[model samples]
Target: MSRTRFKVILYLDETEFSRAAAIYSAILMMNMPNMHLTIVRLKESNQSLLEIDEKCQNIWPTTSDVPQNALDVFLARSKDVQQQVLYSNPNIPDAVTALLAYVNKWAIDLIVMGAGEFSKIKEVIFGSLAYSLQNRSPIPVLLVKELSQDFLEGCNLTPTLTIVPKNQHGN
Candidate 1:
């Protein structure tokens, strides 16, 4: 059977590891041949870089931060990698709406975003974007809280886990 392309959208904003997540996602995407990574940055700023082309190999994806900053990172990558990347910055009024629109438009399989830190009062007043996305997103939403390398190095997930039946009779 042919493997379907797995599209993962890496949502970026003003949060910890937001920039680094792009590089990390790219590296992670490299390992998964069938996976396509699209980096999305929605924050508005004075500077912006808009480069979205399917045939162009040297084009960059859109970013809300300093245009060159995002470009410099991707520019340093090989042409093959650059060509595989597809970027888009939605112009919708609400962030959740914008992200959801892109998700449907791109036929995204998964949505990955950094787990931002927000004060309790702020969350109570404004609400958490991550939480809202998790609740509203049609597909699965993965929240990144730490560097992949750190988490991978610290935890060994290969061990065989024993399964205990939940309906077992009392001993």
Candidate 2:
């Protein structure tokens, strides 16, 4: 008999929200024995899909082979995670469409992302990535917003695992 594993996709980027998402993904996957984690990054540029994939692969190294310089230490605790990169047109519609396609292609069981550190005004004008993904994605999304000091203390996380909140502009 074959066993089915839960596929968890984490939206990754250089944002605090993404860091929160990574933390949530790592902890969740670590607790679930039959889970597969994949960190997905989307680039909004004119780059071809092939080029985007290559770049993503470079940045999205697997847990075992991930370089020491990678920012998220939570991921290194688990060795079963992988990475993927997708590219889309700079437009909102196109980006959402491409993200949806990846969800379907991977049969992703769950989508996890940061709650986005966008200002209220900016989120209203241009929805944040988490907002966009939540609105358009077919799968359930876990939007991790903050890591309380208590939780970090309980986890006994290292300095590399520390995640601080970004400003409203996500800077």
Candidate 3:
């Protein structure tokens, strides 16, 4: 069978460390030969996008704070392909809206995101981003606990092997 193209959007924060980790995890978990990855850093202002995208060649930056523009660009660029948006921060409403817009506009097939790191008390009191996404996202969303070095290294393997345990029946 022919390989299908995949366009993945990774929403990153200010720190490059987390972004790097997320990117590495995405490369491993997605494991599509025709995968195109774009890293978008959400900041307080518009300038951060240029700084991150330009200064850091690896990450694709965007200055559009409004959700529609971000989704439009993603959809227009990744036509006739599987599209996904992965965000580390679940509380950011802008990010949520952007992801939703992408799904609506492009009919995105999957969304992969890292689990939020909020306390149960805080989540119960104020609600959690992960919870919101899980409850509201239109398509399938795979929430990863943490991205490890081994997983990143495994991504480089020619034929990646992901073992999923079978049920007791062991079909």
Candidate 4:
């Protein structure tokens, strides 16, 4: 018998929310046996070496803050997952474009990303990637918020996850 697999991409950035998103993705991957996860981090060309190093340190181990037992399981499941870094300009449009290009190239089935805190003014000046992907992506996108320990302990996921479909607005 053949098994169906899902190709999922986890988008990363330098934010606490992004780290939370990574952890959430790890947990989801643990539960979803048919999922093939890929983590993609976008680094702008203008970022200093130190900044890149910091981000690399945090994301490579997606399970850094997870409990030891859960970390072990997450690590084992992540063996088949891939980590990739894409370099581009430090602009939302450019970053989104790079990710979209990769999504197209990889034929990804879903995109998992964090909804970082961006002010309305900043979002107006520079469009939000989450918003852009919501309107642009052809496949499903999962946006994860920074989850609290209490929430995870209760195993409540609905409050933390937002599923965005192509050209649709998600709350």
Residues 60-125 of candidate 2 have per-residue lDDT tens digits of: 544343223233543554455777778887766777677778778779899887785678899888
Q: 96, model 4: CA deviation in Å?
A: 0.7
Candidate 1 local lDDT, residue 72: 49
lDDT for predicted candidate 4 compared with the true structure: 0.69
Q: Kindly list the per-residue Cα lDDT of model 3 for residues 44-90, writing each as its tens digit.
A: 43332111224443333433321233333334343222222243233
Ranking by TM-score: 2, 4, 1, 3
lDDT of 4 at 6: 84
Candidate 1: where is the Cα deviation over 4 Å?
43-93, 119-121, 152-171
Candidate 2 residue pairs in clash (backbone atoms < 3 Å):
none
Q: Model 2, poorest ten-residue lDDT window?
A: 62-71
User: Cα deviation of 63 in candidate 3 (Å)?
Assistant: 19
- For model 4, the stretches where C-alpha displacement exceeds 4 angstroms are 46-59, 62-71, 156-171
Poorly placed runs, candidate 2 (over 4 Å):
47-79, 117-121, 156-171
Q: Which stretches of candidate 3 lie over 4 Å from their true place?
A: 1-3, 15-21, 24-26, 43-95, 149-171
Q: What TM-score, to 2 decimals, does candidate 1 have?
A: 0.57
TM-score of each: 0.57, 0.72, 0.49, 0.71
The lDDT of each candidate is 0.58, 0.66, 0.47, 0.69
lDDT of 1 by residue, 1-171 (tens): 355878887776765656555545654554555666666655432232333345654445656431333344444433323332223334322557667776787798988777766788987787776778888999998876656667546533222224556555332
